[model samples]
Target: MDQYAQLLAALTEAGALGEEWRGAFERAPRSAFVPDGIWVEDSDAPSGYRLLSKAVDPVGWWAEVDSGRQVVTQLDDGRTDGPGVATSSGSMPSLVASMLRHLDATDGSTVLDIGTGTGWTAALLCRRLGDGAVTTVEVDPAVAAAAGVRLAELGLEPHRVVGDGLLGHPAGGPYDRIHSTAAVQRVPLPWIEQTRPGGVIVTPWGTPYANAGLLRLEVGERGRQSHGRFVGDVSFMWMRAQRPHAVTAPDRPPDHRGPSPLDPDLAEENVHAAFAIGLRVPGVRTLHTWQAADPSGTHRFRLSDDAGSWASVRFHDWDGADAVHQSGPRRLWDEVVAARRAWLEDGRPELTRFGLTVTATGDQHLWLDDPGNALS
Candidate 1:
């Protein structure tokens, strides 16, 4: 079988691609949306990825497009000419399908798609909901224009505009459904404002502690507040405006305190552990690095906040003591331990058990099982 057919068959069998969206997948070929020149990540490479070009190798280009892997179309918001780091691209087919499935948009539903990217998601929505029913907003002008051209070539034209997705395209709404292709630290107020009462908003929501999940919120009748549970785990690039402000790593002075009584490896890399920690310790980001000082290359997790506060936990030996150091007003490690203790008390709840509530005034409250019992 051909690559396209094989992909369709595999997705259908695996249940990632449902019949509801199969028509869009068939009508709008993925190859049509991909750029001729793109970057493909290589795990072993120091630079992390090598650029692929249709001009250089057509066969290899088609292979990667059909391989169902994310092709980086632009880097550093199109400022970096080469493959420095991926800023945006056409998302993998399976993940796109999965998110669409969860979105549950249907005929007659007016939709607003955030972060147009390659415009594939908007095209898919347009195919399903019709042209006038879909409106897509992209932040990068160059990316939006390129996507608009491709979409027009396919006879698909949804309201493709260039603007900050965080502000949302208010002219499009109050839409019946709002879907964002990017991840957010917090749900924006405009989205809630533009969505009709009882409408749904779907996007990948992340925490500073190091976990992200799909958030599906239903705007209340008043349209000021929305509450919903986390559907599942999802990883997406952050919205440009909401992206964390870069802060310098805090120094580990020689006069730092003793080793932590807690084992860093105990809950170091676990997703649920990170999620739990994020609820209690807000406004902190983690970066895991492998120190060469330890031959085993055990990870050293660094915690930092926008306030220049930072801490590091080096797991050199799994069976022995791990080094812990902090130089901040807020004791981040202590917060992590306390959060973990709370998680243990709550029977070690997974991310699925947690939910979020966004007030009309825009305060997000993280809850476990019951919305009334919100975490600070």
Candidate 2:
């Protein structure tokens, strides 16, 4: 076996790729998909990889691999430049295996792969489950075509489609598994619809400022649902179709005082939950959170177009729950108070204990634990 090939086996045995899916890891050549001139950043060394000027520089290109290093294959902002934007990449082998471990892909199982960047993952699915059983889609038509050709070059032929993955590829319906490489603020209904009743759909979902944690959910019949904890924190671009819907934060700084609205102290205690709740509310999109570290006094604002309102919510946790100031239309501070009251009355639950149930056709429903209560 080649040197990198041996390293792949080692990583798999070590549990990075899981023992079950090691077959896929063995056949795929990481070097084949990595262009010769691609820039790589190796923080382990004093400097990054020198820019490769050729595609077929056979010397040392097949060296062994390591883990947890962020490789910047594409630069100059991926939007404008097509060649190096990291439009396609061999994902960190460990992460690939981690998710695959959750998926537990089996022979003959069909998979709908969201975000077929570079077609490396599609190739993995083809290797494990057979090429015809894997259907991959990329919103970028150009990227999809290039990935298809690359996979073909590897002697694999999987169905590659160019369309909004949020809608999924209907032609490849009733898949046994569905995997998305991107993060989403809201889970799309089509994904639930496309998956087999018990099939799994995994993606990252969380606040816009921080990386989204992985959410693995199973679809139930009649729009009923059951899902558990989110996995490790990871970041990825949002899906194209779901871009229109985003969570926009309130404009006020994280801390501030406005005497006229509501109790400030309570607002301060529940401020974070309020912001997370807004994303679940209808008509809310494009959120930006700005917090004031100042303990003295500063009015925190939650601004957004969905509510068509701008308001300040202020409070100090140490001072008291009653110390509040509200200045805005529709009592924005009061709304935060409502969310807090709801949490308190129900025994202030943390995020991990929370469960999400997506039943709506156009929107998703987030419920707490086994109950049917709606969460933003």
Candidate 3:
């Protein structure tokens, strides 16, 4: 408890968290959700796995959770002798704070929490929304059962179900808010249909290649229609159904440097745009990197097609991930060029300038601030 107090204090100072939510943080000690074995990200530590023994440095463990990165508590389907791959975990406390803020959870509202890993977030929701008003779903039976016990320890008993979150819990219908701790590229139609009109559904939406943003959507009169814009950049693992068997090699590597100073702007790849491109260009992989040989003034990129053919590009620019390059036969670079051209033609509007508008008829529209500018 003392260890988490320190963590809470740090969060409170940062203004990333609130004193009001301190009870939720105290009520759910992160140590409760972490397994006995895990890994530490320090340099050159052979046994990456961490243990929960009083003799061990418990303070250090709590500190790691303070960083906003996901911690792997369980790996490789929850079976590992030592340092097994962390397949599941209690997400970082700061990340949880970000999600909760994005949710804007009001008091006494019925909320459905998907991906109840470690049950830490569920308890937090229970604190904000009250018990039974929060229902969480986990795909793994073990995860769901374990979280159920931890919630009980906190004197909370939110409904914890083990099943596919893709098919949201219909039994807990007409929820005021739906929050998914995990990321989903596709906003399942069922979620839109389940929530009450004007209810909010927040999830990290991305494509198989790169879609990264906390998507905030609002359901309307028609249970099936939703419209919203992305807020802030975020990353998450692909849903089981949204993952790729293997990403194709780049047709040719890309040049991190752009054609001109202007290209540098687009070099910062929009995760949503990246994902949308992946869906349109099915089976194309895009990668950007710097020239390791001479780090000073060289850039490279690679994009490959599913057929195993790849393309490479070279240019001079300083943006690492956002750098652009041209490669391969398919001219994936040209595709990026085309999108930018279209965006510019539309008055160089930023993506947020046009938010997503979903309709009950399954019609998805990207609305620009100037409604007249939308290409349709």
Candidate 4:
């Protein structure tokens, strides 16, 4: 079997691809959407990625395209040459399939596809729902142009626009579904407005602390409100405007030094703990660092609000309690500990148990179990 067929078979066996999307997947092969040169993770490389060109190494390039892995298509938004960081990528096939399934689109359903990275998703939507029913928006002009070319080559012409996906394409109003390829800290109000009542919005939503959760929200009457639970865990590139600020340690000495009530490792090890803590504590980002040269195997868990408050917990190999340090007005570690405590008191509910409600006034209320029980 060809690589694409094998990929489809594998996805079918893994239950990632259902019969509804099998035809679309076959029609829009990933190879056609992937760029000629793609970046792969490299530990020894300065930027942690090494580019593999289709011309130079077809074998390696094809392998990456066929594999169920995200392929970085652009670095630094195509601004710089070396020591690159991925600004855009073709998402993993399984993840794409899963997100599409959550979309719950059907024949005659109008879809607004946000973040047209490679246009593969738009093509699939067009194949399933027809070209006129799908509208795709991308913020980057170059990216959009390239993706448009690919879509046109495949004779899949969805309404393509270049604009901030956060605002969404208002011209295509009252869509049956709004699907976003990018992750967001805040669901854009415009999206809710553009979606018709009872419409579904599927996107990767998360906080700065734990940026990974697939959220599916259903719009209410008059498109004034939407409510949904986190259906699964998914990590996607953040919408440009919603990307978190870089976390850095404060220059001055810590204002308070004490022992931590909870093991700092738990927050990093358990995704549910991290997600719950993130929901409770807003604007906090986490960084886990280990001293590779240190023979003692000591590591540090750092937290920062990026508003002058920062905290750190040092974990040592010895059995003594980990030392916690905090500086600035907010005791970041204390807040995290409190959040963790609340999560535990609530029986450590899994991330899926958490849900979000958004009002027309743009208030986002996160809750546990039901909308009446608000957490934030």
Could you say which candidate leads in lDDT? 4
lDDT of candidate 1 over 247-309, digit per residue (tens): 456665623545665677655547777777777888888777765876356577677787857
| Candidate 3 residue spans exceeding 4 A from truth | 1-15, 18-20, 42-59, 66-69, 76-86, 250-266, 269-284, 288-300, 304-310, 315-330, 340-354, 361-363, 367-376
Worst lDDT run of 10 residues, candidate 2, spans: 279-288
- Runs of candidate 4 with Cα error greater than 4 angstroms are 81-83, 290-292, 295-298, 317-322
Q: Residues 84-186, candidate 4, lDDT per residue (tens digit)?
A: 8688999999999999999999989999999999998999999889999999999999999999999988998899999999999988888999999999999
Writing each residue's lDDT as its tens digit, candidate 2 over 1-376 gives 7566666777866867765677787676555555455555555533433343344543534342233333334443245433333333456666776777777668878899998876777888888889899999888766677677778789998888888888888888888888987667777777877888878887766643233456777777755664545655455655655543334444554343435334544433442344344433333332323356854454343433345444444433423443443333444445555656666665765554455666546445566666455564
Q: How far off is residue 150 in model 2, in Å?
A: 1.9
lDDT of 3 at 269: 53
Tens digits of lDDT, candidate 3, 1-376: 4556776788889987876677888777677776555565544555445444324766666665544557666655566454444557777777677778777777778898988888888888888778879989998888788788877877998887888988889998878889987777567877888788988888876644455667788888874557787765666655556554454444444543344333433634554445334434445555655568875455555555556445444555533444444544455655555655555566554444545666786565555664344444
Clashing pairs in 4: none
TM-score of every candidate = 0.92, 0.67, 0.76, 0.96
TM-score of 3: 0.76
Worst window of 10 by summed lDDT in candidate 3: 256-265
The lDDT per prediction is 0.82, 0.60, 0.67, 0.90
Best of the two (2, 3) by TM-score: 3
Better of 1 and 2 by TM-score: 1
